[model samples]
Target: MQNDNMKCGLIEKTESQFVDSIEKEAYVWCEKNWKHDDYEHQHNRAQLTFVEEGYQYFHIDRKIYLVPQHHVIWIPSEKAHKITSEAQTVNLMVFLFKSVFEDEFYQNVQVFAVPPVLKEMLLYASKWNQSLDENEEQDLFFKAILKSLPNFCKESSSLEIPVPTDTRLIPVCNDINVNFKYNLDIDSLAEKAQMSVRSLQRIFKNETGITLQKYLQLTRILKSIELIDTRQYTLSEVAYKVGYQSLSAFTSSYFAIMQVKPKINKN
Candidate 1:
């Protein structure tokens, strides 16, 4: 087992494991099974874990990423990490060597949402990986698969968690609006929507690829900005109204979620 800190020896599976094989020595196919277990592995090759079913929780440094169906997590070559999944989750991985994607991929590891065409193509490849024999079927599936590879090579921020579908989060969001300055904790917000904090956490992750904390911070800051846009309150007053006790706290949160800082003079 590889510790979270140590970069493990490389794990390789034959290209026959993937439905689509690149004619070049750019990638390899592998099946990863981490059901209901906790393990952390790091590598020098950028890896894509495609979730076939169930859910996966990945922690990079201390940030948690939820991987559900229709999504995949990209782990960069050097980051430290840990992943935990419950029973019955199946993940398909296509581990691409650095020599393959070349300089196109980003240095960071993150999740990308699979769109329609790519999803079908991957499903075809996965089924193909399992059904076919390992031989040089070079011209057929190889070329077709490789062309799609480069397009997907670039990182996309569009991949994200779906919004919380729970009947509660919306109302709870409303409650937050009505009582923006309450300084309420997540528990209180969850209770208003009749959900436990853990349940809230999972649903929120499923619906929005980001975490609850990030979303909450975004929400509070957005509210503060909207009110401030009217030019009615000073930055300090707006910050307090949005549940931020300290103006510095509000500014930091605002900048973290939205790349832009809040304007003290919106007029």
Candidate 2:
């Protein structure tokens, strides 16, 4: 006594037919580079970068942000931005087409919290390296990403380090980066920039959005972070390498900049 509806093979439907089909309008991929910096540029598609190796510095809309390893930085479409790397690093970059999501999704620069599920999805998406193009499994994965976007993540504390673009300050910036181990004085920086100390202070603040003292401190702390991540140096050694006179001072500055004391690996 098989029912006519059951006998009509209604239960044999394939999975693809039930899932809503979507046009793939985006891409994801991973890339590695050895110390590179790019000039400011804008694009029609939004970019999300997940750092895998070293620190990334992003300058967007006159402010700079520090993108540390395991973090994702999102740059909205058509925004002029520049990226610089501290060392050799890997980045999982996803370019999302504006048509795939709401306009609000592509509005601001954001640093997102990457929970385990989202992290795994990002990695999985990176493997596609191309649009889904009617592929069922890939389409499902992409669809899952869109579904998980709303509840899977939250905003974290932004790591911003402002850098001035004034050409007069370029030499000063280079000196600090190249010889960060030395105690740099404002007098010397002003002399190097061929301006009075007061003038330098005024202009630096007006242009960079951070005091010179804090900027220098942040630069050293960031360098210390890079050294510590190598796992080859002790806390004291890293402190000395970055020109901190005492471990206590270095730890204070590190905590101030990073919001956590560095976890030393004594192995």
Candidate 3:
């Protein structure tokens, strides 16, 4: 699924050229196992990406979202962000649309479930790319998809983890992400941040709107998801790797946070 420009190592240049030259109201592009470089960029038209297989990580508004299979990532026009994935094989379908609808859903970054109908529409739209003519069949089809988005995209995914902004809490958050396998108690984190336990709890709650203990749980769950996606480790191995002493605890916590049972693909 590598395009000509991509095979020639000119993906960025080709995208810029298309954005500058294309005047159509809609565009669609499909790829397989595409690995975009690590950089932030934005577009004049709003963007929607459907993950048909594997998963993708989106960095938006200082938060990280891991969008798994059968999900969509929406980014509004002019919103700077970066998308990355560690999966070896990914099937992605991206759509770019002009700001025609006034729905608030189009104004923010969101990762949400993809309905069956939307998934079919995305697959059909994959036949066209770069630019679609106005009032044409492809254009009209995409317009209908955009009009129906708000209704279908109501329930957002809970796989997002917000990055702390406070200088004192940043390192603490970083340590939890890096050393999630270890037991990260309040005393250790408080000492690492050079603050009293009481002060750390107050500021952490104020900055991230979640207790430190809850944040640790979320970090471990999200990390577990990433590990599970790799399919190289069994569920028990993943649980231990993410700091859960028992598989039952890991499964319960994952279900509590994601509202879905974790699935392992060891093929």
- Top-lDDT candidate index: 3
**Native-to-model Cα distance after best TM-score fit, residue 27 in candidate 2, in Å:** 3.6
Reference-based lDDT, residue 43, model 2: 55
Candidate order, lDDT descending = 3, 2, 1
Candidate 3 RMSD computed on C-alpha atoms after optimal superposition onto the true structure? 3.2
Provide the global lDDT of candidate 2 against the true structure.
Answer: 0.68
Which runs in model 1 stand beyond 4 Å of their true positions? 1-33, 127-183, 186-267
Model 3, 185-205: lDDT tens digits are 778889988999999999988
- For candidate 2, the TM-score is 0.70
**Best model per TM-score:** 3
Cα RMSD, model 1:
15.7
Better of 1 and 2 by lDDT: 2
CA lDDT scores, all candidates in order: 0.57, 0.68, 0.79
Q: Candidate 1 lDDT, tens digit per residue, 113-219? A: 56677676666655444232444553344445445554564344432223455667777656655766765578887887688988877876776566766666655
Between prediction 1 and prediction 3, the one with superior lDDT is 3
Candidate closer to the true structure by TM-score (higher is better), 1 or 2 = 2
> Candidate 2, residues 1-267: lDDT per residue as tens digits?
233222111121232111212245455545665344366655555667777666687888767777777677777767777778655444445545434466465477877556787788788777666444556776666656755564654654336766678989988888888878988788999999999999999998888777777778888987887887677788999999999999999999888766668765343
Sorted on TM-score, highest at the top, how do the candidates line up? 3, 2, 1
